[model samples]
Target: MKLTRPLLILLAIVVLAGGYFYFADSSDDSGQSNLLVSVKEGPLLVTIHASGELQAKRSEKIKGPDGLRSVGLYRVTIEDLIPEGTVVKEGDYVASLDKTELDEKIKESQTEIDKIETQLDQIRIDTAIEMRGLRDQLINLKFSLEDKKLSMELSKYEPQAIQKQAQLDMEKSEREYAQLENKLILTREKSIAKVGEIDASYRQQEHKLNRLLGFQKKMTIMAPKDGMVIYIRNWNGKRGPGSQISGWDATVAELPDLSEMMTMAYINEVDISKVMPGQNARITVDAFPGKEFQGLVVTKANIGEQIRNYDTKVFEVIVILQEQDSLLRPAMTTGISITVDSIGTCLQIPLEAIQSDSLSFVFKKTRTGFIKQEVVTGPSTDIDISIALGLSKNDMVSLNAPSHADDLEFVYLDQDEKRQMIQELENALTRRIKAQQVIARSVKQENLQSKDTGGSTFIIF
Candidate 1:
């Protein structure tokens, strides 16, 4: 064994040749195996992906000041707000509104009130001076009447003509005095009416100003009870800093009860048909990665709507979480995988192995080469498709079209056999539909009961 140098050199060349041939042969077999994949037997899931947002099942609405319209304010902007999901006690400051517009209104109202007060004072002064002048005229008229009466008496002892003139003068003075007395009474009544009118205007302006002042205090909203703040959503967007609140819809935010929660998702119209109540789902919170929770579809929209910047229509779907967690927060984004259908242990294959034109078929491997196999297919995912019939666990199929596969022979099920397989598939689908119907009925009943029990459900988008 410890022999000559020539013998050792010959052994080295032989060993190198053997390794190169063995590796070459092994690689050829490995490539062949990679092309031919076996029919797998296991569970296959056909799922749909949708994004969701966490929401509370029940919540109390926090509103801006009531009777905003009564103060002539059409709208107000939220100037400041605490970050959403912040916990606080009752009567805590939650948000503040921009009072600049309201303050301007108050200033205008006060100015009007001042104008009314000035008018009132002017009326009082003018009335006092006019009444004094009228009274002085009445007193002078009375003195003239007395003098006319004495003149008439003196004339009585003179000529008849002079006596007649004195009687006329006395009569004239008496009539003048009576007319002045009536005019004085009317003037006093007019002055009282003017004062009342101006005073009424002053009171009205003062009342308006007072209401504006009171409303200004309420512009600072407070939490009605103890809970975390969740902003209310509207067409414009969620109620937050710089968002406008209309007089009619003054809701600012919400205090949600986190004991019960749900995830709201919008499903594309294409995938909506597969979604229904009672179907199970897996939900993952975007905020908390690597954690998943179980859920069930509780509600689906009857109609579809156009979303902003979306190319296709989407239907709203509501899924209720089965468990509660302390880290769950409202409005948190989540990833939802709704399991629309689940097949039990069955034969499955890669989708690439399957090809179709007028009929669905696969290129299955045979003793000599590959052949076209017409298969009855079932539910499928993006990567794999389930075989309802025509393939089994022992079969092998090509992942890609084999070279010169057209020259190969085809193995197809006869019409009767194909129809029978389709019939079986129909029956299974019918069973699943009936089962879903039963689940739907139960979900409906639960919804009705929840309504009777007064549970709230709302979504922003």
Candidate 2:
């Protein structure tokens, strides 16, 4: 029994130690296996795809009333219009501006003119009454002066005291008469000046009223030239009924010369370097599936601008269609594929499989386990890297740093091969910079701000 007890205790200790080691090794290997991913080999075609809309290559603006801002209105609503796509000739009615605001303003101006007229009449009457009163007072003074003069003469035959009093009264009357004459002259001049001031105000108000009346007549817009009417577009949508036209953006509609059409596309700064003038493009209209149109890249902007709702800056790219189709129309959304460049059948792998500092390497699988295998990389996209050297299609790479990867030695290339690979990468980067500069100079000549490039989606293969 003693022998059996000791033997059983030792056996239990051995079994427990074995199980502990087994679980510890299993957990380590499981972690390493999870980080491993296989290398892939295939053709790498880098195609830049962008979304855009069709716009008229050239169009004549069908404008709202000229000088809306001059008439004290910054914006006015389109109250009525002939349906879009209607053919019309010069001098035919196209649209009518809403007269509600204009009518209110006209009413205010007319009221002001009438008020000035009334004020002018009141001044004239008041001046007449005042002048009549002044003249009567002057006449009374004149008669008093004559009587006082006669009295002084008659008193000369009476007493000396009576003559002196009569003389004093006559002088006082003469001074009063002279002062009254001077006052009449000044009053007449003042009345004329007051009337002139009021008359000037009245004339100004009359001119304003006249202008408003003339503008009212022009509120009914007429076509300036002969063509089919196409409603103008804004941030919201096509400017139709109820859309407000402003003095700054006074355009109401357009007469598009539909003989030609072009697409306005927005390409991100990352891919703009790949695009240039005369590059072939394939465009598909969203309104119709399976129908395709061929176009050429006519322009590519060098500078980037902000697009609504996108976080990245994008450059404008213009694509001109080669042929006109009956189904083609303005403002149609299109999908554009511009073949920028392609790398033929080559090896590629997920970008996450590679890591770098001063040197680039991968956690490559080996017969023993995993090792840090130094690799030479080619051009890369946002998500994948092309393999130039140090890995094969059959080889597997770790997506993340495997367990103890920091301690593993790298399977590096020879010094000569490594130096050559570094030279190649530096040259590629230099070439890319020069190409981008060329694209910038080519498309920087024109300002294509008239078209709105929004709601864009992008893809690169």
The residue-by-residue lDDT of candidate 1 on 1-461, one tens digit each, is 56778898999989888744533222222245326678999998888988978988777778899899999888999999999889989999999999999999999999998889889989999989998998999899888999999999888789999999999999998898899889889989999999999888888889899899999899999999999998876435577999988787787888888998888888999999998788999999999999999998988888999977668999988888999999998889999999888878788998888888788999876655567899999889878999988888968787777666677678888889889989988898889878987887675433221211123343221
Clashes of each: 0, 0
Q: On residues 161-256, what C-alpha lDDT tens digit does candidate 2 reach at each position?
A: 888899999999999989989999999999999989988888887887788889888888898888888887755778899998888777778877
Q: How do all models score by TM-score?
A: 0.82, 0.69
Q: Per-residue lDDT for 116 in model 1?
A: 90
Can you tell me which runs of candidate 2 are displaced by over 4 Å?
A: 1-45, 158-161, 268-281, 288-327, 339-377, 380-415, 418-422, 425-429, 432-436, 439-461
Which candidate ranks first by lDDT, i.e. highest? 1
- Residue 264, candidate 1: C-alpha displacement in angstroms: 1.1
